[model samples]
Target: MVLDPSRYQDHRTWKMTPGLLRARQPYFRNNMIGLAILAGVTAGIYSYTYRFLHKDNDFADVPIPPIDEKELEQLKKEYEQHKNERQ
Candidate 1:
């Protein structure tokens, strides 16, 4: 069935005016406050989870193997000889 255009004409007649905006100010403010609260809660949860997951990680005691000075010197000498040959 075809709907009468005249019946829906009232829906299109509404225009955004300063007075209308002023009337809806409280609604917009409430929505913004709610969105901010949700974002803050999400960030707080993520921060807490990240800290909790990484709290036990300690790398200070990890022993680094000592480098042999003789082996390093030999490698350096070989590299210098190769460089001199290339030039």
Candidate 2:
């Protein structure tokens, strides 16, 4: 069951074998890996943006609407009358 050590002795020479010369030469860059990295970055940025925008609740800077107290009272009376008529 002993294996020959001579077969694997020339490890560097295996890359220069004549028939497999094409495999030894460097090839073009892979687009899928680059695209996957870009997608991951974009998703991370979008997630951060969503979290940033939704994190605030107390919007104190915005101006409140000028509501008239008399008009609100009249509206309430009208609503009550409408409800009574309906019943």
Candidate 3:
């Protein structure tokens, strides 16, 4: 049987129809809201993490103890003794 072009006249191309757009409007709106919330939460978490990581230390003004030569020699002797025992 031969197909007739006139019989297919009612069918249109796959362009967006008004009814389809209307049906998907709520879904699109919800997705956009969810995306906005996700973006806001991500930004907040990043900002908080950056601030936590880079904040000024409370102990920055404390002075470090000077190294003692007597303590260094004692530690070296202890380390050598320990190494010999381990071997």
Candidate 4:
């Protein structure tokens, strides 16, 4: 019998046919295709986010001043004093 040419490219139609599904049992056995598809989608989304963050310059507009060392030392001493009192 002549093979149906369309079945070669069409996944849904090809799976429905007895010959293809039965013949290729090893391809669909333990959810291999599903997991591969999920992994590919995750990788694509991660790459897209990385490119967007690196290319954007929105953070440049926000000025960040240097932290005051003296004030930070005072806060740390206060925190330690409070912990000591609690204990």
- Top candidate on lDDT is 3
Task: Give candidate 1's whole-model lDDT.
Answer: 0.80
Candidates ranked, most accurate by lDDT first: 3, 1, 4, 2
lDDT of 3 by residue, 50-76 (tens): 999899698999998887999989999
Q: Tell me how far the alpha carbon of residue 72 in candidate 2 is from the true structure, in angstroms, after superposition.
A: 4.4
Report the C-alpha lDDT of model 1 over 43-84, residue by residue, as the tens digit.
999999999988876876899788899988998999999999
Q: Model 3 — TM-score against the truth? A: 0.45
Return the top candidate by TM-score: 3
lDDT for every model? Answer: 0.80, 0.73, 0.82, 0.80
lDDT agreement of model 2 with the native: 0.73
lDDT per residue for candidate 4 within 1-87, as digits (tens), equals 566546634555544566666767876755787898899999999999999989999778998887799988998999999999999
Q: Per-residue CA lDDT of candidate 2, range 1-87, in tens?
A: 354334434455543444344553444245666888999999999999999989887877889888799989999999999999999
Indicate the TM-score of model 2. Answer: 0.38
TM-score of each: 0.44, 0.38, 0.45, 0.34
| Lowest lDDT 10-residue stretch of candidate 2 | 1-10
Q: Model 4: how far is 44 from its true place, Å?
A: 0.7
- Residue 14 miss distance in model 1 (angstroms): 13
Q: Better model by TM-score, 1 or 3? A: 3
Clash pairs (backbone) in predicted model 4: none
Cα RMSD of all models vs. native, in order, equals 7.9, 14.1, 10.3, 12.1
